[model samples]
Target: MTDWITTPVEPRLLRGALDVERTAHGILPHRLPAWARKQFPDPYLAMVEAQPSGVRLALRTRATAIELDVLPTKTVYQGAPVPPDGVYDLVVDGKLTGRASVPGGNTHTIDMATWSAVTRPGPMGTARFAALPAGEKDVEIWLPQTEITELIALRTDAPVATAPRHGRRVWLHHGSSISHGSTAESPTATWPALAAARGGVELINLGFGGNALLDPFTARAMRDTPADLISLKVGINLANADLMRLRGFSPAVHGFLDTLREGHPTTPLLVVSPVLCPIQEDTPGPVAPDFDAPKLRFRALSDPSDRTSGRLTLTLIRDELSRIITQRSADDPNLHYLDGRSLYGEPDFAELPLPDQLHPDPAGHRRIGERFADWAFGDDGPFAVSGG
Candidate 1:
């Protein structure tokens, strides 16, 4: 065996994460800040955000071979086929050059039928990349977007150092699991990552799965985070969680915007409603899983008649979001709104059906990412860069 140089993972070598917690076993990257994490202390958020969605290790090295020791906590839904192995995307000099994944780690199994769960421990595994070009180069190994990865060690044939920042515009985004890359094939394949790549911007994704409820702490986190462009994908989580009514959603959105404006007074801000979800389009929610079906599926349980009583629904949420942005944009020219339907509407659905009646599949993720890039970064788009 060739001698290898092992190095401790450092904060300066990480990108797309807000913070990194050095744990007893390894380094855990977090999408949310400590204060925000402390504020929302739900186990679900803690677990999901700690999965390091949209996070990556960036470095400059001449190493022809490298290895990363990681402990990945993978989730398994009871009765559902095992999820595909978590994938690590390797990008070199801004180009996707490779991919890798370790064999095993921790497992959390949940039974959607009974709402019960169990956790089982597993051993750390290593991901190895060899035969890389021989020369100093920028390299980024994007952590698995859907797995809670505890980075244990990094080893290479040569020394490694933090990659120099490219001075790209930073794009900060917040949303639900869709933005968190629910069904994406790999970390960089997540919609936000894909859009950031196409838009030529640095990304900091705050897409907490099932937790993007427009909480004040989330808004505060966004307000404090520096960014050249920002976007918020709202409504679906609120409705699915049955967290609020229309009466509260409007003000909540306004407050969220108000807080963000406090820190990003003139930064281009975009508000995008939920994409096409037929199950919740006209119907209200508190979506429930359909266990009877052979494959896992979801159905909204709230009554459509609840609309008259001020309950939230996709249609209502979209209308309210459009109105709020139109009213606020009159004085805040940097504020803009894009109907989520424009990104994935009925027509798109007819073309690419949502497998679970909720989250989009990988192809759907690509479609959303492409459309988002064209809409937000295209010429005449609000966030369009000069000559981009």
Candidate 2:
């Protein structure tokens, strides 16, 4: 009997369904990236709350050798139309096989003629890709584009290997869009992904876009899930969403951590604050929506005067978080605190300005990923926080 081994992915075409929602910028209709549009045109749209909007992709094989590519959509500051030609390459069996050209990268401008498949709308999007030949084949997929949001890889068959058993258990993380991979070129390139890989740890990414609100339900969810190491990246969204005041934030943060500690009294927990955002570094008052068009969406927050004057800053967030951690540390030694600037900072911002006054670009993602890998796994790092 031949010992058939499962591969990470099979040799056939692939299918995907993306649940996403358009927020902050509501001008353009929601659509797949340029590369995806080429294969599947005419997707459906709908209204949903709390859940991400859905989109799908189908990969098929037209030739004996299969190849494909993608260029993910990126954040265009204040909806300033993304650039053209955000193309990506597709690979099969560790070899470059095909290519995709995402014209404009966003707004459904993909043209995939060399391959075959139909794009339709159902739940998410109904799309189909060809399957692989019979027998065992090893497959590894990579995304060449650097954009934000989620990319889930589903295979037609089970992987040949089981989850490797390292000395320690897996670490499941929950955080903001940053943890979801804001401007990462590929899934594996995200900072969290890179950190997990470097640590040789299994990871379940529960990162939702604009969804880290320190909610009781989310905290309970984390409390209920099984994990070894747990971390939460907070602050920026609360500030951006204009959700609450400092007084309200402190208790909410404590409640969030308290709930997690209930389930994991001894689990090493890391609390991370927001990275540096120049515009909000030293300014006060909120960004007023243009009353003329509530949905116009603009950068009312970035002001040369405010930056020069020194007003709103991440230091405020860091200080608040530190105060909380200092108090909690007296009772919880397993608790750890991390400043986001340790991963990316003002100096780095000079090189990569995040396009929008917020969110890291691809290069920024790379920098953060590398820095995190070094800090969290270094000789004296806190990779493992033991408890009595």
Candidate 3:
């Protein structure tokens, strides 16, 4: 029998994380930098950023079998059914070869009525995968897209090393829950991930669930991160969270762009408006979950008439983003805009409606990914050949 070798999970073996924290349990990958985390230390932000949406361990090895120890913390809404365990994707030589899920882990339960949460800790678990063709190959362990995962240990039947460079462009994306892959089948099945695969670029997803409200710190993070391509899927969370009005929204958008330009003056930046969410299209938001339904559903709580004032709506946001992008284009040719409806609109809703009047189903994610690949990464797209 071959003796199993335990390897230290180093930073070089990981990809897509802006920072890695050494916790008492293990090394935790963080999408947001330390400064940003300190500035806006919202529990929700901490959860989503540490959830490792597009984060993965990239390494080279000839191991026939491997095991990873992790402490996964899954979020749960009270009264609503608990979601299934998150999946771990194993990709070898650029192909998804295996998938697994850790059996037991902590559960963070949230009470919707009071908007409070309590975490019930559980024992650590391991994800194991076996059987390889042979010879050294690049291996990527895509962590759970929604769960906060603390990587504890890595043991393999053979030695492991750093992954070889593939010279792929780094794509940095920031958005809301949809971009965070709500209801998507797996980590790689997310719209951004699928698009990245098609475009042949490295993905750094900053799509925090329910937290894409034009925060200056978030924009600063995007500015500081080294990325060949960058995109911002704006509006959904902004409207739903009802963080600001039209007056503040426009300036916030400008400030966000200003920060990005500070770090990358000429990088191809795409600002995407919100997709067609019927509930928020005409209605002002501050959306709330409707627990009356069997499955979780959300309804727009703000008044539609408030639009007459300075309230923010999906339509208003789209128009503002379009006008801003059009004006900014004169000075910055690299800056561009895409109506998110082009990715998912009424036509899409007719065929593939959002499951809970909020997030798209797996099919919708795939469709969005396919269309985005053609529109943004195709021959005539912005990232055509020399994206950098």
Q: Give candidate 2 regions above 4 Å deviation.
A: 1-168, 284-313, 385-388
lDDT for 240 in candidate 2 is: 60
* lDDT of candidate 2 at residue 55, scale 0 to 100: 16
Ranking by lDDT: 3, 1, 2
lDDT of 3: 0.90
Better of 1 and 3 by TM-score: 3
Error of 2 at 148 (Å): 12
Residue pairs with backbone overlap in model 1: none
Model 1 regions more than 4 Å off: 113-116
Top lDDT model: 3
Model 3 TM-score is: 0.98
Candidate 2 lDDT by residue in tens digits, 109-174 = 222222122322211111112344444443333332233223322334333332223354566676
Candidate 2 TM-score, true structure as reference: 0.62
Q: lDDT values of the candidates?
A: 0.90, 0.52, 0.90
Task: Kindly provide the TM-score of model 1 when superposed on the true structure, using C-alpha atoms.
Answer: 0.97
| Weakest ten-residue segment in model 3 by summed lDDT | 379-388
